[model samples]
Target chain A: MHELSVAQGIVSAALSHIKGTGKVREVHVAIGELTLINAEQLAFAFEIASHGTPLEGAILETRVIEARLRCIRCGREGKSFTCEECGSAMEVLAGEELLLEKLKLVEGDGDAQGI
Target chain B: MHKVSEIEVQEDLLAANRELAQQNRKLLDESGVTAIEVSGAIGSGKTTLIELAAKELKDYRIAAIAGDVVASLDAGRFEKLGIPTVPLNTGKECHLDAHLVSHAIEKLPLNKLDIIFIENVGNLICPADFELGAHARVVVVSVTEGDDTIAKHPAVFRKAQLAVINKVDIASYVNANPGRMEEDARKINPFLEVIQVSAKTGHNLQRWFNFIVKAVEDRKQHGI
Candidate 1:
């Protein structure tokens, strides 16, 4: 349930990135497999936080990546789904990421604000 | 009229929490309080161990921060012991992060405390992922929880500096093999300090108490 804290981070990051912009259209996030963040909950939290801010009505899109593990014993780089070589427990090298990947800010008038 | 534009961005979502945790860690270091965090499943007697410590360290100015989902009852229990206890209700959250701990610390008279104990929510899985600025992380397990807890939650057990096997008095009635539990924990964490105690009856509680006192004293001596 650290998702609320995680969501607050997302909102802060998005607001910082979109400062000076007119409004925010959407927020893009990248979630890794091992982060334990629930996307739906995060989205809901974002919605609640974005209210009355420049980010109101913004959509939250999350891109989830599978966890990757590196085998220390065999020097094998593979997916953690299962270790093909050595069969030893795999050490996670990446994909535990909880990142605010992209932000889409809206500015300018409708006629000139071609996306 | 609405306009749409895209901005490429890359940021870390946990940056804020991590920063707060770092700040709390610094505060803990500066205040000279050796912060110890304990995590375990429900009914593992985490609070009982802390209560035992509080009783033995009556001369020291001690404080505790307890994290629970639905209750301030645990903190109330600690308050009755005459220790300053801060309750962090995580709502639906499963664990307390550095931010909550730091806030709770601010509410306590941190400068006067010799040691602070943080009892993480009753969980073995989620608490391992977050660091709450503790000098030591102790993982408690009762015999009834199962002998294989160490093996089942290797992540938690591996990260723990000390693994406590509580309720040793009931080990026989529950058919729990304490030796096997210790061995399995050792296999996961060879450097772990294993202490067996029955907090219900004060069985070997002195060992646990002495461990905390020594660890706190050593931290002060080593300037950690």
Candidate 2:
């Protein structure tokens, strides 16, 4: 699915963000529900996509974010786009993000200090 | 130093895509072109729908960008219809990302065209995560695929502005219900417009053509 391509993006982003030489240990990502990404599927994809990269054994740690919906007319809050109170469509305020949050790296032999 | 440590990055991975998509939208707006991205599974009549549009929408100058994993089969079909066509192949990627669409748009005479129909790499799941800088996104689900196609792939429906249940002529033989698909699509997104048609027989496709016309008109008026 799209998870494999996204996992490759995570590995590449991690590689570019790190300073100097280091073996990546873990890559943390925040996945939102509205993005429709399955965390377990992403983990499996990360394992495969990172196989030949610097993040060969790096763990893909994902955090899920819930979607926040709000209705405009009545200012009511609900999950689905259709509002229960007003019956009008709700707007999405949060969730829809796929961000690379953090990275854990093991310093290489040539590395002098931890980043 | 073999020490292990964590560093904060907080980088947005999808930012590049969103930015490029925005750029593409701006370019299309400047050129007065309305792009319609059609996504569906293989054999879902995506090409046929576009072919019909090319033949019928004579008032508008139409071009096409066909995305496939390999081969230019779809592009060839568009070319045969006397339409300018660009074939894009994403070697291993499952979806047509904004980066790829922008690359294809560069090769086209954007200012000379009134509409561009982008046929996404045939599939439901992967395309949902990717937006190809289209004013309207339509998902085509055929009767041969099954009634549960829309229910199983809600993400695509949620992202699309409209949904098309195609191959209605053969629905009885296949035991597929287009009404169920239409219902499922509307449940996911209230604003989404669902239409059923048979591209093969040219049945009820005028409504879909009307949708394209209205979408272009709306985009022109809304100034997005």
What lDDT score belongs to each candidate, Candidate 1 first? 0.81, 0.87
Candidate 1 interface RMSD value: 4.6
Model 1 regions lying over 4 Å from their true place? A20-26, A38-59, A63-96, A105-115, B1-5, B172-180
The per-prediction i-RMS, to one decimal, reads 4.6, 3.3
Clashing pairs in 1: none
Task: Write candidate 2's Cα lDDT for B1-224 as tens digits.
Answer: 37877889998878778888989999999889999999999999999999998899999999999999999999999999988899999988788999999999999998889999999999898788777789999999998999988888877887888899999999999998888888878877888999999988888999999999998898889864
Docking class of 2: medium
Compare the candidates by DockQ and give the number of the best one: 2
**Candidate 1: residue B168 Cα off by (Å):** 3.1
Error of 1 at A64 (Å): 5.0
lDDT at A38 for candidate 1?
84
- The window of 10 residues in a row where model 1 chain A has the poorest summed lDDT is A106-115
TM-score, per-candidate, Cα-based: 0.77, 0.91
